[model samples]
Target: MPSADCDTDHRFVKSKVRLSVKVAPKKRGSCTRKLQVDKLHELSEEFRRELEVRLDNNEIPDQDEDPENEWQHLKTILQETTGEVNGFSSRKNKDWFDENDAEVEDLLKTKRSCHAKLLTYPNVQAAKAAYRTACSTLQHKLREIKNNWWLALAERIQSYADMGNTRAFYEALQSVYGPVNQVQAPLRSSDGSGLLTDKYSTPFWVAGLSTMGTFLVTIGTYKSPPSKTYPNRK
Candidate 1:
């Protein structure tokens, strides 16, 4: 009889060996059972090292094609399975995955199917480019909206200032003035004036000047009549 380990029970089945763990009998809870070598690839030293590296990085090693990449990734993970086996065994196998290998393979098969389905969509790189374009457009519109808000707020503050509302004047100053003001404000400081400086009350300023010009032209035309003295001499 082969010697038995104190922590385990072993038996032979169909020329294959099986091992069951013996837990501390004094424990109150249910004992846990585990298949020691749950995967097939773990049986091979070369594949098991690859699996460890992939798992540590959470990334597959680069492959030339998408399908190949998927396959390689799955192959690395498949190390934990026994080949050509449908049932699990508690015994550690140097060659095959425990009975749970089939389940793990099935899960991987489902994932591969899902990934293949995603491949039917437009080119992923192109999709990302389009997404970036849409994001940029949205950002531009948001900036315009913000600028318009600033213009309205500035107008409101000017109205309050006209009415001698001291609080509103200060609050208006604290609010944003937006892009146009950035260069204009500094230029105004240096020159003591700015381009279209009277734009703040533009409508009133323009209308008054236009009305004055029209009135002056009308008066000048009326005062300068046709040459009546030349007609009398003729």
Candidate 2:
């Protein structure tokens, strides 16, 4: 049998071996394509037809059915139908930048690889030249990508404005330039006495204004009969 020292050494070696093995992280899928509006409409229609058929067959759960079972059935129907659709997998949210951004990313990766090669062969003139060229190309591609993105956004905003869609135009504006900060009004009474409180609510202010307006309007509307004789004597 192995001695106690030998067993302790074996355990240490096993732990060291386990730590040396590095587990690679799982990679997420890329959104290479987006679903078109027409394709989305088609999917909606298909789902509606399926739901109608289920209703006709009396397959829908009633109020007395278990909530969990009802939810599971609905989820199953949606998932199965969506899986059968061709464009569902590629559907992703729209990005601020267009597809050219992907090309820019690929160019940046190439530039990084070229830089690595230059570092590996520090004395090689060809490696240095290649790295320099990659850097130049990457810069040019980045400028072009940004120019195209801004142009596309400007065109969208202009189109929305021309169509008289102020809401959409503002939405596009906010997306590109970010939201504007709103100025908060001071919460004080008309006389600038103090901050408004529950005792001096908006209705209280409105009622006071209404009473003042009524008094002003009726101040000289009715004249005393004696005032006519006093004006003649003057």
Candidate 3:
């Protein structure tokens, strides 16, 4: 009989293979806005100075005596500095689209209030005119802000490319196009055989391509080439 550990491993591998086949790939998550590099560098300098001051005052943990305490102190300091510099919780990833949505929401609220006022004073044209003006302003500002944002992004991308920083240039492109999502293929063959059967079996990561090639060879058939080109031409 097989050992309990072996049975467990078999079940785990089987489940993973089934899941890989059944589950569909998901789209990439939204990208969060990042702080500028220069701003981050400045924040790092500030953190270092503050840490040095703490050390001088004998307020920081002594790494030589208590390594754990020193680690905790360092971690806390880094978290605080990161929060301040990056606006950790307070900062929102709002683009022009989000800004436009907010402006539209505000305009809706204004229009509702104006309609309420008009219901009380039916002869009032002022509220109606204000609503129309607000609508026009929203449209104009949305187009202006979106156009400016695209112009700024284009300038940023051009600057990175001009500097010959391929990494940054591609990163900028990814920011616009979004990152690609990679999914792993299942380790089982179409015949429901596990790629690796036991400890002595070849490791999946090492022999994955060769195993796939073997599977293809088994499933695929080759047809002999025709003896003569255009045999039916006559």
Count of clashes, each model: 11, 0, 0
Candidate 2, residues 1-234, lDDT tens digits: the string is 222321121322223333566888879777555334445565687767865675566465456578887788777665555455534434233344445767877987887787767667879999989988988897787887778778988999999999999988887877776557899886666567665677667766787789999998898696767644444564
Q: Flag clash pairs in model 2.
A: none
lDDT of 1 by residue, 185-212 (tens): 3323223544355564466557668898
- Candidate 2 residues lying further than 4 Å off, grouped into runs, are 1-44, 53-98, 179-234
Q: lDDT value for candidate 1?
A: 0.53
- What 10-residue stretch in candidate 3 is worst by lDDT? 1-10
Q: What is the C-alpha lDDT of each candidate?
A: 0.53, 0.68, 0.64
Worst 10 residues of 1 by lDDT: 91-100
Better of 1 and 3 by TM-score: 3
Estimated TM-score per prediction?
0.22, 0.48, 0.53
Which candidate do you rate higher for lDDT, 1 or 2? 2
Instruction: Write down the TM-score for model 1.
Output: 0.22
lDDT of each residue in 102-152, candidate 3, tens digit only: 766775676566545644665768866765675577667668879987888
**Would you list the rank order by TM-score, best first?**
3, 2, 1
Scored by TM-score, the top model is: 3
